[model samples]
Target: MKVTIERTALAKALGHVQSVVERRNTIPILSNVLLQADGGALILTATDLDIEISEEAPADVAGKGATTVSALTLFEIVKRLPDGAQVRLELSSEEGRLQVSSGRSQFALAVLPEDDFPSLSTDDLETRFSMPTSDLRRLLGKARFAMSQEETRYYLNGVYLHAHTDDDAPALRAAATDGHRLARIDAPLPDGASAMPGVIVPRKAIAELGRLLEDAEENVEIAVSSAKIRFGFGAGYLTSKLIDGSFPDYERVIPKGNANVLRVETKDFAQAVDRVSTVSADRTRSVKLALESDRLRLAVNNPEAGSALEELSVDYGGDPLEIGFNARYLLDVAQQIDGETGTFKLADPSSPTVILDEEDERALYVLMPLRV
Candidate 1:
């Protein structure tokens, strides 16, 4: 392949697909990106067996050809080249090398046959839908923090997306949990989304897909089948294999009849949790929250370290209740609440507590109490 492209455009396209290439791979071709140049455009494709990303950029195509080269190395090379310089890439089939030259710098990179690269198919998608990029970003961003890192319960390692109804209106929901804490967010269902099937998007796919949605105004087209999912947007497409496991019944985990209620500023609660956690040890980083008629006190006690206590005025109507929770968990949930006040529904000290953003009714969090 022989193509000439602007340095910045090439780097941006490489940045989109190179990260999906695994550095440590048993197969040499898996670490390389497939480059195809034809008709004044250059297409870059990369994959790690499970997820694949492809991006296209405008180029001056001297010849129509395709080859493979190391993704990270090419990314680094293009990144270091002088800005606005025109870069030329040419493949020497006899030498099995790719020639990269920009201004005074030149380098030869080893090339692999494009036929060796694996291809992910999207033949039979059961459903297809389109939604605003900003809405999709919010759904994934709010629930990703609660996704499980432990692989033992592999089913809990992704966010569950399904069609749901909110306030008698069709809505799309994304939920995730690690047994200890859970997060759920909902967005208004877009046109042609009523028939979308439920799918569990793995943690890796969630992160990569999020990076692709930087432009809020752009629309994302999503296609899903029983075993795979595909996201197509401007100048590119992302394909990922589904987890092939069943997610747990997340609706049952959310508490239903929590009576006690407490309302406090989200910022105040997050900061108080951060302050008290300083005195907590690594193993048991627990903070106790004592709620009374109109006062809330957050305290953390560690025998080896010191103790921290902070008080905040809140609106609490139920009887006094004392609860223990992981300081980190509290902070994670509080940071997601964008409104002025955060509302908490409590059943008791031992039962799971539910938190809701007063201004954002579409999102809710459930945190299990820690035994202090």
Candidate 2:
């Protein structure tokens, strides 16, 4: 395969596809990227047998052929080339080498047979819909932080994406939890998504999708099936295998009828929690929140280090309550609140509490309390 591409354009495409290739692979071809040159563009595909990413970029094609080369090696060569340089890639079938040249720099890389590269099957998707990229990015950002990292409970290792009805209106919801904290966010359901099935998008795919949508402003097309999910935008597409296990009924975990309520500025609440947490060790960092009529005090105690206490004025009129929570969890939830004020609904020290943005009803957090 022979193709001429601009350094900047090729580097950007390689950056996206190479992330899917693992650094170490038992199968030789899995660490390489498949390059196909056609009429006017070059297609790059990389996969780890689970998640696959394919991207295309405009290139000057001198020969229509396909080959595979080490993704890391090729990317490094292109990245080091001078800016605005035109890069030429040619495959030497007799020598079994891929030659990359830009200006006076040149490198010969080993090539693998393209026939050995595995391609994921494209089955008929059960549901296909399109939504603004901004909306999708926001949905994932709100809930991804709570996704579980443990592999044993594979069902909880991803964000649960589904369609639902909230307040008599159709909505698209994203939720995640790690047994200690939960996050739920909703957006207006896009057209043609009523029949979409709930799917657990794996953590790796969620992270990749987030990177893809970083500067996107257009709409993103999504296709979902029982076994897989695909996200398409611009000249790139990503396909991922969904978790086969069933997610727990998360709605049942949300607390109801929490009589105690407290409202405070989000910035103030987050800063206090951050300051008090420094007194405790990293592994067992817990902060105690003491609430009274209109005051809230944050305190942390560590036998090895020291103790810290800070007070903040709040809006609370219910009975006094004291609760212990992980300081990191509190900061994460507070940072996500879009409004200036953060609202907390509490029942008791042992029960889970609900937190919400004073202005946004579609987003909330559920946190499990720890024993102080």
Candidate 3:
């Protein structure tokens, strides 16, 4: 393969796909990126068995062919080349090396046969739909932080995406939880997505997809099946294998009868929690909330460390109640609240608390109390 491409364009495309290639691989070909040069463009693809990413970049093709080379090495070479310089890639079959040159710099990388590269099939993706990129971003971004990192509950390690009806209007929802906290976000459902099956998008794929969305344009095309999911941007696409497990019925955990309500400024609450938690014990990082009338007291006490206390005026008329929570968890949920005021509905110190964003009613969060 002989192809000439602009350095910036080549680097951008490589940055998208090379992330899927594992740094270390038992199969040598899996560590390399497959480069196919043809039709006035260069297609770069990389995979790590479970996920595959491919992108096309405009190029000047002198001779059309394909080969595989170390993804990391090629990316590094292209990144260091002089700005605005054109990069040329040529494969020497006799020497089994790929020649890379830019201006005055030249390097030769060992090549693998393109036939050895594995491909993730998307033929079975029966459900197809399109949504605005911003809507898709909000659906995944708001709930991803709650995804479980523990492997024991394999199904909880990713976000649960499915179709739902919110107040008789079709909506798409994303939910994630790690048993301690849960986040549920809703967006208007796109056309022809009502029959789409609920799927658990693995954590690794979510991270990669988030990065790709940063460069994506106005709309994103999505395709789903029982076993896999695909996201197609303008010039690139990502295909990932779905978690082969069932997510728990998350709605059961959400409390619907919480009576005590406390409305506090999101910024003040988060900052107060951060201040008090400074002296909290490292193991628990617990912060106690004592609410009465319109006054809220935040406190943290640690025998080895010191104690911290802060007070904030809130909008509350419920009877006096005290609750304990992990300071870190509180801060995480606070970051998701986009509005100035966050409404907290509480039943008791032992029950889950529901937090809502005053500006965006479509977003909701639930936090479990700690035994402080």
Best by lDDT: 3
Candidate 3 lDDT by residue in tens digits, 1-372: 899999999999999999988898889999999999999999999999999999999999999999999999999999888889999999998889999998889999999899988999899999999999999899899999999999999999999999996468789999999999999999999998898999999999999989999999899999999999999998989999999999999899999999999999999999999999999998899999999999999998898998889999999999899999999999999999999999999999999999999999999999999998
- Model 3 off-target regions past 4 Å? none
- CA lDDT of each candidate? 0.91, 0.92, 0.94
Q: What is the per-residue lDDT of model 1 for residues 215-260, given as tens digits with 9 covering 90 to 100?
A: 3238888898878989887789889998888888888989999999
What is residue 68's positional error in candidate 3, in angstroms?
0.8
Reference-based lDDT, residue 369, model 2:
96
Best by TM-score: 3
lDDT of 1 at 297: 94
Question: Would you estimate the TM-scores of all the predictions?
Answer: 0.98, 0.97, 0.98
The local distance difference test score of model 1 is 0.91
Clashes of 2: 0
Count of clashing pairs, candidate 3 = 0
